[model samples]
Target: MRMIVMIIFLVLLGLLAILNRHFLTYPHTLNLGFAEYKDMPVGLMLLAASLIPMLVFYFWASVTKLRAQADTAKLLRDMESLRTSLDSQEGSRFQQLQAHLDRQFAEMQTQALPSSGSASEVASLAAKMDAMKRDLDLQLDQMDDYLKRKLG
Candidate 1:
């Protein structure tokens, strides 16, 4: 929207310049290191001078826009790559944690379920199993919360 308004304003300015072309009347001349010119109008000269800066501004704007687009594209690609890497890493880590948890539970079962011939021994073993289960649940809940925060 801003670009459209700017373009409209530039067109009006150019029209104004063209309409005021007769502001210069006397003969005018210009010379350069490599060339020479004569009979140039002051109004026309003013218009050309104004157009030179506008042209330069347009070229600079285009170059800057292209650079910005390239940067954005590069950033998007990097983001996608990072996302995929994180996903793969997350899956592998979850699997590793699950396997580790299963091993720990199996070890706990083998140690807790045996040699419970007496009532007191059975009670102690039951208490130990409950503590291990609570610990495992706490760790799992912490892991879940960490993953939710990280992913979000």
Candidate 2:
């Protein structure tokens, strides 16, 4: 496809250049403060005028393309680093939460347990432990929901 377009453009350019041949031999001159060109062809003069800007634009486009690609690569690297840090932070938060839950369960056992020898006291302590276990389960479910919401 690209070659076809280029070929078509070349044919058009050949026609244009040929059509301009009558003007090509027309005498022209260009002068600078320190240098001078005399009896240059009109075609050569026209070619120079058109070519300089195209060269400039090509270089400018190439530079900008490279800069944009470099910036995109840097952005991707920064995002990957940020993602890893966030994952570590999330892991630490979960570990801390689990440790805290363990401590709470230990405290419930040590503090709510009755020293009485009565069966009633034992039963009451058992019920309290069961409730604490359910509370822990509820907290875990809430944490799972929070993570899903955050990630999704």
lDDT winner among the candidates? 1
Residue 52: error of model 1 in Å? 1.9
Per-candidate clash tally: 0, 0
For 1-152, candidate 2 gives per-residue lDDT tens digits of 44465567557766877888778767788677798888878675676576577567667877888899999879777766776687679778867976886787667656655655444565676677679767977886786677556544
Residue 44 Cα positional deviation in candidate 1, in Å, after optimal superposition = 1.3
Q: Give the TM-score of candidate 2.
A: 0.53
In candidate 1, list every pair of residues with a backbone clash.
Answer: none
**Per-residue lDDT of model 1, residues 1-152, tens digit only:** 44676698789987886676567444577766687778867666766778788778777888899899999879777766786677679768877976886787667667666555654565676678678867977886787677556644
Rate residue 33 of model 2 by lDDT: 75
* List of clashing residue pairs for candidate 2: none
lDDT of 2 at 78: 78
